[model samples]
Target: DAGVTQSPTHLIKTRGQQVTLRCSPKSGHDTVSWYQQALGQGPQFIFQYYEEEERQRGNFPDRFSGHQFPNYSSELNVNALLLGDSALYLCASSLEQGGGYTFGSGTRLTVV
Candidate 1:
């Protein structure tokens, strides 16, 4: 199944370059939300996907995008990468009740 099979991990991408990060949920979760967290700062919501379609989005630009597969696996694609984008990219899977967000242990992405 496309469900999660293990704990989520971090991904690092270079500055000014595009990168694709992958995450699979074993909890039978269909919703995937992405966030960018800078050092000493709270996580900033990027966007969320459900049922293989874009559902909700944060203030991030179009450069931040994502996709959810029919199998429940998800991908977060960052385009036109910039130095300011340096931070932790976290993927959370939940029912979108607006609470109880399950996320990976801070994935640090440093640019430069």
Candidate 2:
């Protein structure tokens, strides 16, 4: 079975702009979650989606949004990005039961 995959291993942007990152879940998985990890901090959950609807979310602003597709793939969109938004955007997929989660290497977004 295939594992999760992300694109553009690295990214660069400036304040006030917007960006989008993509992800594909591991085979047999139906839920996807997005996380942001700072250089020295544990990943902070952004949101989770199941059945194409956001089932749960963390303390993230409306600027952070996502979408899940029938194929179990996902995309994270951050609008009005700020320097503080610079971090590793990770995508993890698991079953609705909250097990078998697999994380992607991540898309590094650097804000200038």
Candidate 3:
């Protein structure tokens, strides 16, 4: 079965623009998590979704939002983008009962 899948492997956006990144979870996984990874830095947790509700969020500002669908697919939306937002956005999926996570290749977003 396919692991998590993310869309638009690379993107370029201008400041103040908005971007939506997508993720489809692996088979049988019911939870999805998003992360942002700057160059030379480890991934920082953004938020997590389960049962179509945001279960937890990290230290990111309100510009970041997410949604999880019935099928366990998810979307990460960023509004009023800033150059500092440029980074590799990662998607991970795991069972709600706790298990190892499967991550996607990640979407590379660059804000100018």
Identify the candidate with maximal TM-score.
Answer: 3
- Model 1: per-residue Cα lDDT at residue 65: 83
What are the runs in model 1 whose C-alpha is more than 4 Å off? 1-12, 96-99
Candidate 3 displacement at residue 30 in angstroms: 0.6
Candidate 2 lDDT tens digits, 1-112: 7789998799999899999999999988999999999889999999999999999999999999999998889999999999999999999999987677899999999999
lDDT of 1 at 5: 33
Superposed by TM-score, candidate 1 places the C-alpha of residue 51 at a distance from the truth, in angstroms, of 0.3
Clashes of each: 2, 0, 0
Task: Pick the winner on lDDT between candidates 1 and 3.
Answer: 3
Q: Give the TM-score of candidate 2.
A: 0.96
Q: Give the total clashing residue pairs for model 2.
A: 0
Rank by TM-score, highest first: 3, 2, 1
Query: Cα RMSD to native, each candidate?
Result: 3.3, 0.9, 0.4
lDDT string, candidate 1, 12-81, tens digits = 5677788777767647566787888888899999888888999989998888888889977688778988
Higher-scoring candidate on lDDT, 1 or 2: 2
Q: In lDDT terms, how accurate is model 2?
A: 0.94
